[model samples]
Structure formats: C-alpha cells, structure tokens
Target: MVIVLKNQLRIVKKNIRQFIENITSLFSSKISDLLLAILLIPYLISKVGIENYGRYVFALSLTLFLVNIINYGFDLSAVRELAKNRHKPKMLKKLLNKVLSVKLYLTILMLVILFVVVFTIPLLRVEKTMYFFALFLIIGDLFSLRWFFMGIEKMKYIPIINVGSKLLYVFLVIIFIKQSEDYEIIILLEGIGLFIVNIFSFLYIVRKKRIRIKLISFYKVKCPVLK
Candidate 1:
C-alpha cells in the first residue's frame, strides 16, 4: 500500500511540473508582448509628435476595425482545433490551411476596399499613402500569425518575436529620425518594422514545422467532439 501511494504521488508531481511549464511559457510570452506595446507607444509618440501620432492611432483603429470584419470569429475555431489536436500534424495542417485560405481571401478584399476609402475619404488625413498600406499589411500578418501560434500551443515564441521586433524598431527609429518633424517617416518605419518581424517569424514556423502551403481540398475537417 505504501509503495502504491508513493507511485501515485510521483505521477501527481510529474503532472504538476508539466502544468507549471505550460503556464510559465504562456506567461512569459504575454509579458513580452505587453512590454513591447508599452515601449513602442512612447517611442512612437516622441518620434512622430502629437498630431502625427494621433493620425497614426486613427489609421491603426481603422485597420483593426477592418481586420475584425474579415476574421468573423474564425480565430476561435483555430484555437479549438489546436487544443484538440496539438500533436497531430495532419489535423493541424488541415485546419491551418483552411483558416489561411479564408483569411487570405478576406484580406485581399479588405485591402481593395481600404485602398478606395483611403483614396476617396478626405477625412482620413493620412499624408503618406504608403503608411496606410504598411499598416494594413502589418495588422493582417500579425493577426494571422497569432491564430497560427495559438492553435499550435507554441505561444512562447510570440512574445519573444513581438518584443524583439519592437526593440529593433526603437533602434531604427533613433537612428533614422533626427527631427520630430519626420513623423510620417517614423510612422512608416514602425509599420515596416512590424511587417518584417512577423514575416520572419512566420517563415521560421513554416520551416521548423515543415508546413506546406496547400489548397485545402475538403470543406470540412472533422473537429473534436467536445464533452
């Protein structure tokens, strides 16, 4: 009886360790992301000045609004699949392909509509049209990569990449912008920074996981039956 109890305790301890590791990984990732945002905002404001910063914020808000329209709650579906089949490559690939296909199409459509709005809408006071273009790409790429990571349960990488990118942006901002008047350039720099970082990270994941970008043939992959 004592031997059996000792074995049970060992099992419980092992489980506890695994749980702790998962939680720690997630916590570290989230903390890094929050820190990046906190640092980037001040750097942006200082470099861009108040008026330009306000314009940047408005552009970002509009980008977010458009992203939400394309997403249509598909993020939740990806998360559910990732949780259920983290270890199954085939399942993960299928779900990811489906989600990516839908997102890609939606993103293209949104870009077209946004291009018209930015061009026609006089209220969007965006001086550099390239800045809006960069903003759209950055937001779309980041959002898609986020869903991919969440599904795979490899979220530890997200914060590291996000924070590292922001840090690089800070360095670039200081190096390039000597005057506060260069707000348009600085804003464009910020967007370009995010775009480059996300692209690198996304490529890394694809290479590491050997994920092939194939067209999803079937409309539906069997999802896990929840209890």
Candidate 2:
C-alpha cells in the first residue's frame, strides 16, 4: 500500500513538472516571436525600402483579417470541446474532423471573397502579385492545428515548431533580400515557413499521438455538430 502511494505521488509530480514546462515553452515562444519581429522589421524596411515594405504589410493585414474569419473562434471553442471530451477517443476524433472540415469550407469562402476584393479595388489590383504571395499566410494558418496541442495539454511542441518556423522566415529574408526588388520575397518566405512548420507539427501530432485525421464531408461539417 505504501509503494502504491509513492507511485501515485511520483506520477502527480511528473504531471506538475510537465505542466510547468509547457507553460514556460509558451512564454518563451511569445518572447522569441517578438524578438524576431523586432530584428527582422528594420532590416526588411532598410533592404526592401519603405514603400515596398508598406505594401507587404498592407497585403498581410488583409490576409490576416480573412485568416481570423476562417478560424472562427475555434481556437477557444474547439479546445474547450476537445478538453471536455478527450477521454472518449472516438468522439474526439469525430469532433476534430468536423472542426477541420468546417474551417476548410470557411477558408474556401474567404479565398473567393479575398480574390474579388483584391481585384475590384484599383490599389489592390495594381499590387496583385504581392497579394497573391500573401495568400500563403492564410494557407499556413489553415493547416496550423495549434488548438489540438492546447486541447490535449501537451504544449511542448508548440514553441519548438512555431519558433523554428519563424526563425526560418527571418533567415530566408536575411539571406535572399538584398534590394528593394526583393520585397515580395518577404511575405512569400514567411508564408512558406509557416506552412512547412505547421505541416511538420501536424505530422508530429499524428505520429506521436496516434491520431488519425479523416475529414468529414461538407454535409456533416455543416450540420450543427460544431458550435
């Protein structure tokens, strides 16, 4: 009986330690992101010139707005749902599929809207290429299943994967952007980095957690299953 009690205590301590580590990882990731942004922004503005940098920022802002719409508060709501139903593997898997499918549909709709908005406006139409590159950001965000890690309460991978991806973007900009003409590469690099890292994260989750992701049909996704 005493041995059983000792084992339980050890398990509790391990869980607490892991929880603290995950929290620290999250904090560090945020700090790294800020630092990277600070380091990259001035360099980009100097290399690409203010006007081009402004264009990239403008395109990014529009893409970000659409990205958030597609996200649809799933980061909060889906995480809560997953946490509540985590013990039931079958239900959790179904919920994950539904959430992803719904987001996919939203993303397609937003893409169509973005295309129309970008082309109809003269200012946006003039810089359509830059806007085209910015579309990568939305694609990256769509594949980034950060909520899954948060829901499962195994957040150690989040910092590593995200920071690495952002660092890659910074590296690419520094290496490739030598003049004002290279400005378009900035957003393109960022999008590429984001997409690669999130893909890796998704694969890691599937392999390590043994979670299969079979997206549900649109009909099922549109059902009131996910609120």
Q: For this target, which candidate reaches the highest TM-score against the unseen true structure?
A: 2
RMSD of each: 4.2, 2.3
At residue 172, what lDDT does model 1 achieve? 77
| Model 1's TM-score against the true structure | 0.76
Lowest-scoring 10 consecutive residues by lDDT in candidate 2? 218-227
Cα lDDT over the full model 1? 0.68
| Per-residue accuracy of model 2 over 1-227 as CA lDDT, tens digit each | 99999999999999899889888989988998899889889999999899999988888888988998888678788888888987888877787778878888888888899889989999899888877887788888877878887887878778888898998898888789999988876788999999999888777766776778887788767765466
Model 2 segments beyond 4 Å from truth? 1-18, 223-227
The parts of candidate 1 lying over 4 Å away from their true place are 1-43, 125-131, 135-143, 216-227
Provide TM-scores for the models. Answer: 0.76, 0.89
Provide the global lDDT of candidate 2 against the true structure.
0.84
Looking at model 1, how many pairs of residues clash? 0
* Model 1 root-mean-square deviation: 4.2
